[model samples]
Target: MEDEILGKAYDGRLMRRLLAYLRPYRGQAIVALVATIAASALALVQPYLMKVAIDRYIAQGDLAGLNTIAVLFLLVLVGSLAFEYVQTFIMQMIGQRIMFDMRMQIYGHLQRLDLRFYDRNPVGRLMTRVTTDVDVLNDLFTSGVIAVFDDVFTLAGIMVVLLVMNWKLALVSFSVLPLIVLVTQWFRRNVRDSYRTVRVWIARINAYLQENISGMSTVQLFRREAQNYARFDEIDRGHRDANVASIFYYAVFYPAIEVVGALAASLIIWYGGGRVIQGALTLGSLVAFIQYSSRFYRPISDMSEKFNLLQAAMASSERIFALLDTRVVVENPAAPRQAAGGSGHIVFDHVWFAYRGEDWVLRDVSFEVAPGERVAIVGATGAGKSTIVNLLLRFYDVGRGRILVDGVDIREMELDALRRLFSLVLQDVQLFSGTIASNIRLGNTDITDAQVRSAADAVHAGRFIDRLPQGFDTAVAERGATLSVGQKQLLSFARALAFAPQILVLDEATSSVDTETELLIRDALRVLMGGRTTVAIAHRLSTIQDMDKILVLHKGEVRESGSHQQLLAARGIYYRLYQLQYRDQELRAVARTDAR
Candidate 1:
């Protein structure tokens, strides 16, 4: 629906913001503008030269003068071509530079936006803003903005030449102008609607494709390939039909302009030919009027096309600026305080938060982790266990109360400095496309090859890395698709270890791996947790039995807090959780023994 709103064809405010991108390239834009004017002037000269050659040289049987005028005509043609090339090349280069600058700005803004923003917006829609919408603005810069001057200058020059030659014939030529206006208005209205439809369907196509491709494995596993294909075909067909309808308007518009031009030419010939017979107009003048009349319609047609470009650009700029203007709900402090280093003490002082209004995900959740202490948070689904971890890392700020690190409110510290103090590993490991070594270091130049291998070896990830032909240099596919789930989890651990943060946060980090892999990781966790303040969130109660403290949450509130034995002795929420897992494990053991 947002895509369907085309807004105005020429919005002054949007145009100003779009023009700001040109500020850095104003010099090149000026050059292109001057070249465009020069080219238009040169084009106007060609027809006049025809009049001069016919009336002064050819009519008087003067071969020498005719030859001279022909040479001048050739020179004018060459000059025009050169200026046209300069104008086109310069504008194209400026467009490309603007696109680069805009994309960088958009991506930087996206990175700064809080997680809540991502929770509301879809990835496919954002991708359209960066890729498709930016491309439409590029067309405006290269073809619609500065190049419009050529059409205006040519149109003005042609009108002046027509009136100077013969006012009566010019009036006859101008009679068709009203018809051009009517046809253009009709074309503009219809084309704009079709263009909006095209944009909407394209965005839908993009969103559908991104969703299906990312979930292709799930679709295949469920045997829903045929259903998904049918859905995609429907979306693709909508995009195609919208485009064809837009093409239909274009197909009718151009030929209509040509027909009107031909009518103008016919009027000029009919009226001017009689005047020549009446000794009021020269034959050369009549020929020149015909040429000028034909040239005049060209700019009119081009301006109509440019109008469509301007309209499309206005719609695109609206979307882009909306995204850029989204206020960052979580922002760094203006005068940020430095986070105290070497101490990972964190405290949540009666924090309250919600992803939506008043429906709290976490309420009055209070806890603390002293430096070098290990804490675990356990809860049922939607029990606010991970919300506590999210709050500590400042992914989303608390609505009430505050979170502190090292006795200073995290809101008072620079975002990057605060986040650098902790390394996070989640159940779903996210690996980018790169060599195995690069994924571990993640572009941190200080991490050396020795450090990378040591981190992998410490976490037992090197076992698989060494098995690969390229070892640490092996390339990883998108999302680490080439690696097993356990292998990916190990690499994630290696990554966190390589970063060597003062605090470690694991959100169900080992849940995806096998029992053998989990045992290897449990062994490595002893070394990883030593001397580091670690916050672990887990559904498996076995993993956190030895933690210094355990917080049990239920329905957005902490209901129990103690060591494993203390909570088990009380026989409350934590005791019930332990009993459930213990029974499940016993049943699994019995089943395994019976099968043997």
Candidate 2:
């Protein structure tokens, strides 16, 4: 589990990058900005109107003048409310659109990334990037950024209005401005660090919860519930402490603003009241000075809150950009060459590979499978059997040497065209939650219902599929939890058959089925492998006995290559493996006979 890297409080580079996403929605953003300025100007008008009403109508007892000022004030109030609503709505629309684009771009990039990237990163952390990190950016767009403009405009407008009315009194009312600035700056500095802590803890909590919940069954099976709960509580406590620290900064800052506001108001009354009495300033002007001063502090306080949001959004943007900036290790060639033939002739020319640098998993392993031939790779658990499949599929590019498909170097061929040559069925069959037919078609609309059923029938999966309540239309649970292991394997075969690839790769496909189901699968395999080049990774010696060729691997090197009887006579790695499996089966049979 990796911790987040903390960034600068105000990163100009990141801000510029974030603004580029808003370029497509420039029209909406401009409209929202105009609405913000208009609303702020409208709000500024009411206090000035009040000043006029007092000076021209209330003191002189002019009834018509008072009525007129009252109507103007009411009109400005209504207009301000309407413009504020429009600004908020437009900003929200822009935020949602930007979020949509960002999420789609991130998800699409993840799909193109090599398997090596996924092997290093966790699903939970990536989920946070697409869901929670993107959401924080949305808040910045909808509230933090636009509200910043509104606050500055409102504060500047009030300053200009106060000076024009009475510079001396305005200067007196502005006496508390220095203290407010000092307090806000101090608060921003402290809260920025606190907010970063909160964001980190949030990511940690998400990672922990996702991993534990996903593996809950394993936790229960091992009876580690109490210990797991204690670990989770420790993580959760750190998150709570982080939040409390941020709350403390907010608690101190908001009240500090209120105190500064009251002090400024008191100063204005003391200075403006004596001036009014001395006949230098009118009562209305004195009252208006107080109103403008309060207005000034309100924006400052609101801006303080927006600063908190900005800090959190900045941290999230750093993480999001880091993900987007990751270079795709495996990419298609710019000017790709085509394969010579479409017969699925695969040749590994001394291939070498590793998930990470220098620590090799496959070391100078070489083999070839001719067109329409069946080849089986037998190896111990960590003997690089699956690495062969991974490298052939270009999941991770070979660290050295090259692979050829149909006489063309795989690196020179387009990735999509290279992958389309083979149909892969893994040890763990992944079936989505959809109908049996949909699972067989697997989002390729070209695979018709007739084709799906024919493939299912060919693999003998149609027998069980037809017996279901809705036949092929029956829905599968997530990962096919509702189906048995053999049933899932049969559906996988149906899927591979429906795709109709020239080469078939099976990674321990029949290792998990029962004896009866294995018989069914063996019969199906004959039909499935008919005239198609097949490469199988098998642990069971009986399954690959009739394969056209056998490659025995030990510690990432091929030690033997021959037919079953031929390898047995050679008395190498394969012969010892056969003897071990045979002896184990014989012991199981003897035990069963004694029990009877």
The per-prediction CA RMSD against the true structure, in angstroms, equals: 1.2, 1.7
In order of appearance, the predictions have TM-scores of: 0.98, 0.96
lDDT by residue for model 1 over 392-476, one digit each (tens)?
8889999899999988899998888889999998888899999999999999999999999999999998999999989999999
lDDT tens per residue, model 2, 350-377? 9888777888888888889999999999
Total clashing residue pairs per candidate? Answer: 0, 0
lDDT for each candidate structure:
0.91, 0.90
Q: Which residue pairs show collisions in model 2?
A: none
Ten-residue stretch with the least lDDT total in model 2: 1-10
- Number of clashes in model 1? 0
